[model samples]
Target: MIAFASFAQPPQDAIFPRHHPDVVDDMDVDLGEDDFERGYQRLTCPGEPITSSQAFMRGHGTYVDNEEVIASVAGTIERVNKLVTVRAVRSRYNPEVGDLVVGRITEVQPRRWKVDANSRQDAVLMLSSVNLPGGVQRRKLESDELQMRTFFEDGDLLVAEVQAFFADGAMSLHTRSLRYGKLRNGQLVTVPPALIRRLKSHFISLPCGVDLILGLNGYIWVSKHMSQSQQEGDAFDGEAVYSNRNDEIDGATRIAISRVSNIIRVFGAHFIPLTDTLLLEAYEWAVEQEGDVRDLLQEDVGDALVATVTAHN
Candidate 1:
């Protein structure tokens, strides 16, 4: 049917870098022509060996040999037949059905909220799927179109599940489940879609108590939940220490800015597996910045972060 093989191995030094300290995190680990020039090798199809790299790239699918499968990103892995899927930490892979996801609202249709669910096309959020606070059954009343639409309008972030796939390639989504809904007071960290483990929604608690939403769909959200509003974002997975907000300027605001800013650096093909402790340390650093640099958080900090983590490791 579909042509897909597992991963394969190459010579040493040819071992493709799983996560490069300089590469932005959201990158695909493909054996491009340039990759060959860089001496990068295809390690495995889901961790399988490849005797011939060129032939394998000619559409010959490969799978991991035996059962030794290490995650490319630090996410959960799902063994679907001969193909093992990778889901990055904090995000889930968007499968046909029963997949939990954390998505950002990229656009708003008349009655649907267009969500970027870490895929090529944006998933639709129909008016009927949301669960209002009253439990009165959300019915998208007449006034809702004019008023509430702005509330969940474009740019609103949500955590949902793939309710069903439409015949037209688009997928229907629902947030009625408790574990599925809006994500609040959390930092959205985007990594290469491959880093995540597949098939399950795991809430990983970092060594520093940071809550990580590992979606099988390839989107991860990491943040500290200790604070009533927002916790002290640190640089490591060390213990939580209190500090003076006044001395640090816009404490929580800067942290929010920094956390969201870090997303761009990691949401690509070139990414690494971040440990729970490392994630916590980064969070702490974001919360304690000051001055005009407050807005500097939006920049892609992935390169620098990668370098720092690499040096430490």
Candidate 2:
């Protein structure tokens, strides 16, 4: 499992001189060894020299400069074999094949819907990619094309997988399975895409009667949990899968959803990588506080939550 640990900043006193009486004392301190030497590595600044051309091949976020590989973005240096790359601490999501993402429909074209997935270019959701409201294997006729908005219209949010890419590098998305469709009974939360670590399953159901969809593009969906029997009765029932309306939500479930959303917001503010374990721990801690869910957003409370959760991590 990937750890959602936060990197704490180094002490200011360690970086600057406190007593200036002795020049030898300052000179004797080895300033070259920083947090990078320790377990927590330092971030590489833009244009910082990373390695020699003969030693490592240039990768993403790096450029060749005078036979030396330099960082093109401020991020952490990642080395894979002889290739060196820099992963920006915060960047737009880069879609990979089979990556599950939640996106909002920006425009409805002739046979495709333009989606915003927090990338440089909008992703394309083709009409043929979705299962029509009649049956799983139903053919999409020209009449179906005229009523395409009935399935997904402008400003609708849906979860899908990266199917392919255009020549210009824009991603093409698909939603053919029951698991990939319109999102309802939920609220969306935005965070840094980097905070959401890759997991075996992005769909998470908490015991508190809330369900979570961790999108690779940092679009999180927190909603009421539904049982298999409630949702998986008949594949022929397209309304169950494609309906834009949300199921009836109770007061308890609503509170649980808000609580979980707030917990995610707190984690994002601390720049902590998000994982199932970390979210559960933070939720429990927040509940123990015996305060309103909104209280977690307070500066002092957020700090305490980060410190406690990171300590446990």
Candidate 3:
């Protein structure tokens, strides 16, 4: 029988520095021989003894047995001071507060929307937490509650921030900011959540006129770029926030969006943590090769692209 471990937040100074602001780049924590001597083993298997419980506290992917901390899963071992955990090589998305996520509305309730954010449970987006048509600070009237579906109905996609967590660990989401709202003029791509690193900003715009929303939950939004004025100016249409209609997209822009999306898939398939710089390079390489956008997925071509883009990294 295999045990699936629950998610735990890494310590402030842990190698998996998801919560740290200083480490902005995608990085691999290299544990050398000297580091292993200091109790930082690279991997562990089930039932393997890790350390004495008296000397270290057992964390996720570990259990206390016979006064010793034993691995409960096969994965890389992570240590933070006296705490030890094994991060599974492949697992469901582990969410944290303040994470930017792209999610789909699964169910519309009385005053909230249930969003499937690829977590253990669906997240909640309260009616009070979203911005109404008129303005950001407007109070939610009874009429607004009645018209909640108009703002966010089932099957709609949105980009939002993880505002807080409920008593039961369900995430509370909010779209109060102008940047967070219904997603349109794009396609969604699903990848391993581990491939998305916590960066300074999840929103990325490539030179090819495509915008990306790198959801920490592994849902990626590839869409046409909207200018700053069109997105946030005084003349921006407030009612369009919930409009399901997509604007007219030209052929060139559509191809660019598809190309960017395919490149992301290639990187994800290789288990590479994506970054803005790496994506831009990949795009340039693809265009220079003059291969059809669909050709990027060809095994030989994809391998070549990945090798070229990551050669210097």
Which of the numbered candidates is closest to the native, going by highest lDDT?
Answer: 3
**Candidate 2 residue-wise lDDT, 1-313, digit = tens:** 5865343444578778676665563212111223234545446878787777777789999999898888889888776667777888889898898998999999999988999999899999999999776455766789988988988889999999999999999999998876778888999999989988788999998888888999998999998998766655533586666677778999988988999999898888777888888888988998999899898887778888988998986
Residue-wise lDDT of candidate 3 within 1-313, one digit each (tens)? 5763212223447755456687576433433334545754477678878777887788999999888888888898888777878888778888898999999999999889999999999999999999886465677889988989888889999999999999988999999888889999999988899999999989998888999999999999999999867887522466788888898999999999999999988887877889999999999999999989999887678778888988967
The best-first sequence of candidates by TM-score reads 2, 3, 1
What does the lDDT come to for candidate 2?
0.83
TM-score of each: 0.50, 0.86, 0.86
Q: For residue 39, give model 2's deviation from the true position in Å.
A: 8.8
* Candidate 2, superposed: residue stretches over 4 Å from native: 1-42
Off by over 4 Å in 3: 1-41, 234-236
Count of clashes, each model: 62, 0, 0
lDDT (0 to 1) per candidate:
0.52, 0.83, 0.86
lDDT-sorted candidate list, best first: 3, 2, 1
TM-score of candidate 3 to 2 decimals: 0.86
